[model samples]
Target: MLGDGSLGNVGSPPRVGCVAGVFDLFHVGHVDVLERARRHSDRLVVAVLSDEWAMDAWGARPFVPLLERAQIVEHLRCVDEVVAVDDVRPEWLTGVLGVQTVFAASATDGVLGVDELDGIPPGLITVLPAGRGSRSPILRAAIDQRQSRSSVA
Candidate 1:
């Protein structure tokens, strides 16, 4: 278990879990979320949103390329599977992965625009709070400030 409660296994039915994200900048917060998801099930499956999907939702290309982001997550010891999420509905992900639980950042406010997930199969959803100072807003602000300073200098 990494931290959130997922157990690792080799054989037998894996108690699979899922977490979906754009993972745009791949910061420490992203690491914390993935590590936590790994602790909640026997296997943690990470879904990295495709660049097109992310741009549609968030309006910009990610700092890292989609393949690079997926590879980074795949290499983590806590992640069991890494897949691309090209659709908007994350609930569909639980079904596709046969996951026991789906993890997300609590700060996301269940606002994935998918109607209530109550009826979805493989039905369990958990939202982990963002780690201290680990958020996209904070990271974005820092980047902007740094750029401003460098430009001024």
Candidate 2:
């Protein structure tokens, strides 16, 4: 789904929940967060960061492109909808999709800091536990190391 596009299921959609991430490598951590988010809401809406925005925010381009990433996320069992967004504007995303709860898998001091969640209502944001103690930065570093080693050998 691009922009506000959504994927519909055969059953009635329930409460709206939104989760945003780069989802570059689409690893187990991403799966963990998405699964937890689905448990909280009947309808889970995911927002994937664009490659350009990812570079600006995370200082690295996604290995998987935005449209492809969106397609990958759309196919996930935990996701009811997938949105390709430029930035991680959680407040705007919540408002746009009528999201009841915003699920975050990042540390408060790191990615999902207070500044990114300014306009969202209190208690609406649920900070989920990290998956295998891994986040984007850690995953990216691991991938980079592998790539470097491969290139060296």
Candidate 3:
């Protein structure tokens, strides 16, 4: 922690929001959440799950590596800073990162459940509505179809 009791952000905005996710496939849903998150804060910090964290949490490695995923998220207009994280802790976000709000994709969908926001105040935890679709199932189906076609051929 910096002298300010949080990460060093010399000129950061007063309201900084954070969004943490695997962001493996970089799908439309991811963009929607980030755009929505940006609206609630002056600056948005996106925490891309590290490959090790992804495997440990979801039991599978991300198709896109950590650096590539971070790069993709880093270029998004809605995101101000992209950091790779091994875990998502509410205390760390609020106490260590100077984050005023933590934006989550959904409350029940395991992105950031209500129970997980223990340290952050209820008002500071924003559970945005779920996006249209996710990448995991879609990508899995596509891969399965390709494998079937190859096997048939």
Candidate 4:
């Protein structure tokens, strides 16, 4: 929302895009999706999920706290705005933030569930292909392995 270099013309809403994630590890895969989201719209808002919500949805707490996680995403060069949210509903951005597009990691496995995205305007969503080794599950495994080896020593 800062620069005027990319804002849409007057009388039309700005071309805003939104992406949400737990961002526990803040790995390159997170970067990949945000980069893609940036491409889909003029302004990109990255919403980092709160620790409580992450635990409720995924059954495990994020290794990183919500404020720290949001700070991590805020530093990304591709992101225009960053918010920490307890809810991951796409409508929050579309209905309140004037976001015109929402970038998801995939049709089946993005930050949002299919039900949350229901009723979204057609063609307003972009699903990026996820690459291996960048997902939280993979990073979490690595952390688990390192901790296990250290504990055994």
Q: Give per-residue CA lDDT, model 3, range 1-153, as digits (tens).
A: 222234345575457888888787677777777887787777789888789987876677877789999999899987789888888777778787888888876622324545544556787788877765566566856976997899999
Highest TM-score, which number? 4
After aligning candidate 2 to the native by TM-score, how far in Å is the CA of 69 from where it should be?
0.9
Instruction: Please provide TM-scores, in order, for all candidate models, with all chains considered together.
Output: 0.71, 0.71, 0.75, 0.76
**Which residue pairs collide, candidate 1?**
5-39, 5-40, 6-39, 6-40, 6-41, 7-41
The TM-score of candidate 1 is 0.71
Question: Which is superior by TM-score, 1 or 4?
Answer: 4
Q: What are the lDDT figures for the candidates, one per model? A: 0.67, 0.71, 0.74, 0.72
List pairs with backbone clashes in candidate 3. none
Each candidate's clash count: 6, 0, 0, 0
Clashing pairs in 4: none
User: Which of 2 and 4 is the better model by TM-score?
Assistant: 4
lDDT of 4 by residue, 88-149 (tens): 56567777777877766642233663345556665777666664344566667899899889
Question: Which parts of model 2 have CA positions greater than 4 angstroms off?
Answer: 1-13, 107-121, 133-139, 142-153
- Tens-place lDDT digits, model 1, residues 1-153: 333443344455767877777777766767777776677777888878789976876686777899998998899998888988776354565556777777656543322212323344434666666554356777777887998899999
lDDT (Cα) of model 3: 0.74
